[model samples]
Target: MDDGNVSLDRMRTFVRVAQRGSLSAAARELGIGQSTVTRHINELEEALGVSLLGRTTRRVTLTEEGSQYHANCLQILRLVEQATEEARDARRVPVGVVRVSCTSALGVMHLARIIFAFQDEHPDIRIDLNLTDERIDLAREGVDVALRLGPVMDDAMKLVAIGASGRRLAGSRDYLASRGRPARPAELTNHNSIVMSNVAGSEHLLLSAPDGTRLMVPVSGTLRVDHGLAARAALAAGRGIAPAHLWLIQDLLDAGKLETVLDEYDLDAVPVSLLVVPERAGIARVRLLVDFLVDEIRKLPGITPHRSASG
Candidate 1:
């Protein structure tokens, strides 16, 4: 090995040159002189006592040893970078546009409240929320953070399960009075069920009978909407009985407009998750938002029991 002094900058030059396949292109990318890039690569190769690059008029090529050395260099550099990023303030809590993606229902129903609360904690940050019912590709969409209902299948992003909400049957006192109170889960089949359309395609609801026989009923109604808020409103209007998030109907229920049905049956719970691409979540503005939102979600009335406790 040629005993020569090498710096991080020279290693960077070598990597850049190898990537571009030419010193001129690497120099252009680095905004440095071509001669300087060549010097740095030469110096790095001399220091390692290995031929890192074979220079030609047309392009640069790597030898067998150079290929292995390049991989090691990249890994080492990445490790050092990650450590540096952790030590530095990722600048996560300041004011900036954080692009957030979520389903239209959640973004419209719950995201606004959380965003307001998060903004109160971080006044500088501005949230750009994109609402969609369809699945969005985070990388293609260029979203910084996303609030999702239920589990995420993609492992490319990190997921934090903030909390969950369950579907509950609700209807107005008038609607119940008009249709008559259902005596059992089997009775639901005879009544009008305000099914949420997106969920109707699947069998997510559980129904149990008087004889202790559990039946999973795939329900339907004349009135079905995608949004939870709309379903709650429809129920309050005595339009039809609907399945909804309990928190969304609390005020309506409190006002005696809506009543819960089939409480005895075991219903499936929907998970709320925070999906963040590493680049943004690792930064300050996004980090603060994720943390704040998680805290608020935990305190949500639907998920938490209302009891005497210390703050």
Candidate 2:
């Protein structure tokens, strides 16, 4: 078939009809009349010289050749759409709805503020922020970007390192005064520990000494919480010592509301990263949001921006 004879609109219509199983349903989704939908399918079949759909009064079914063509059509349509979006994005004015997913603690403590500030700067872009601790399937959920702590779990995602957040053992001033500070990591067993259930390895505190020696101390507490914010609140209220992100509790630590414990040991930094769906990575809004986050998140207290290994 000549390239000029094939229509992108017809391909889209056929794919939609294949998915919806009815011309009326595809027409409704496309905001076109049923007659136009039928015309598109007929034109598409004529161009390809094959019947793409077996139509019945009840539903539409694909023939064997139609099934193969449908798959190819879906990929072709996606590429065309992506190309169009890329052309539009070349203008550099990010103008679209970007859906973002992040943990509740990070969203409430820092991400929310950053998003609002970003929205103010780019008034044309709309942000839909979903805050939850549950792990989300970005593709399934239609999330453009995700801000996550620790390592990127999905290898399929494009990972951009935002920064490094180090956790430090902290306790309220009153709690420290009443319970007495532990002279060594081994002594932590005696004090009440505010365990964060959400954090991995919360049951044990990993401490490293100045000489590069590491110690894994078993910890238990009366108060255990699943959320990071709740755990921080408990630690700040003189409950017990817990490993808290420096960015989250820096203000309290500076104000003497909380004091750092076992200062001699250097704790490793947990990498904070932004995950973008591979297909969405080329979108202007997603790229802009990622760069914005990389710049702004580094500005937060105690957050060290991650550098590439070559850098």
Candidate 3:
């Protein structure tokens, strides 16, 4: 028997036999005939010139030599599998589906455009966009990446901080015209505001001045809503003033439907981040999409890009 005759198949069969301790059981596990398993074991032993197994009518046990060889075989098989996967990943094309999760308002108002542009660039890559505000389990829901606002609490996820999303005090032109723009942050108390009930401390407004002065002003509203789109609609309807993310209302501001009130006062910014599943982060399509999203998101009007953060 030649050393070259020790094939991977034979080693696998031998390992299976060593694990199962029965030729018939190994055959069943390998989806092969018992004779085939026997031949592999015999050939493996013959090639090595060692009695690898002690056999009886009921069961087979690994010899000391077999025990050592089984350990080596396991290591070799694992290495082979890892190498194969690495090679495949290295050569994989930027194709296939990338499942993305984002908040509803951001998805509809901004992210949807970015996604459409991405698809146009990578015609082969398909997108499954899940627009929801819920913090979903990425692994359980099979999400490749998630774009979220605020802090991402999942330590298991790989995070890429796109930026801090800046907000401004804004209201529709008609509303500001009727109610009058607040000349100072304190004057906001006299104006009707559209508050986002979902945000923490929505009842109060925090503003920072260029002179390093911070003000905490209590705010009240006739209409308090939980979603961005609703707040936007109310603002467009000349409802009241509210702190709005720049990306959410940039178009309205451009069209003169909305105007920034108290532009000198800056509102607190929220962290915008991309959370990727650790396993999927290595895939060609997912990586490409994530990179594209980061670049695009950084270009948004009120985004202040930050140093990358990963876990």
Clashing pairs in 3: none
TM agreement with the true structure for every prediction: 0.65, 0.74, 0.70
Clashes of each: 6, 0, 0
What would the per-residue lDDT of candidate 1 be over residues 1-311, giving only the tens digit for each residue?
54554777886777777766888988997899999997888778778888888878899988888878776666565556545545555443365567788877566767788898888877877887888877776754556788777667979898777667766777889989988987677677777877777764542457554566767765667876877667767888898766677657777778787888878764556777778977556766768788777777666546642123122
Cand. 1 TM to true fold: 0.65
What would you estimate as the lDDT of candidate 3? 0.86
Q: What is the C-alpha lDDT of each candidate?
A: 0.73, 0.85, 0.86
Q: What lDDT is reached at residue 198 by model 3?
A: 81
- Work out candidate 2's RMSD over C-alphas: 7.0
Q: Compare candidates 1 and 2 on TM-score and give the better one.
A: 2
Compose the digit string of candidate 3's lDDT tens values, residues 87-181. Answer: 65677656667889999999998899999999998998889899997888776455779999998899989988888999988999888888887
Candidate 2's C-alpha runs over 4 A off are: 1-81, 309-311
Query: Using TM-score as the measure, what is the rank order of every candidate, best first?
Result: 2, 3, 1
> Higher TM-score: candidate 2 or 3?
2
The TM-score between candidate 3 and the true structure equals 0.70
Per-residue error (Å), model 1, residue 206: 2.0
Best by TM-score: 2
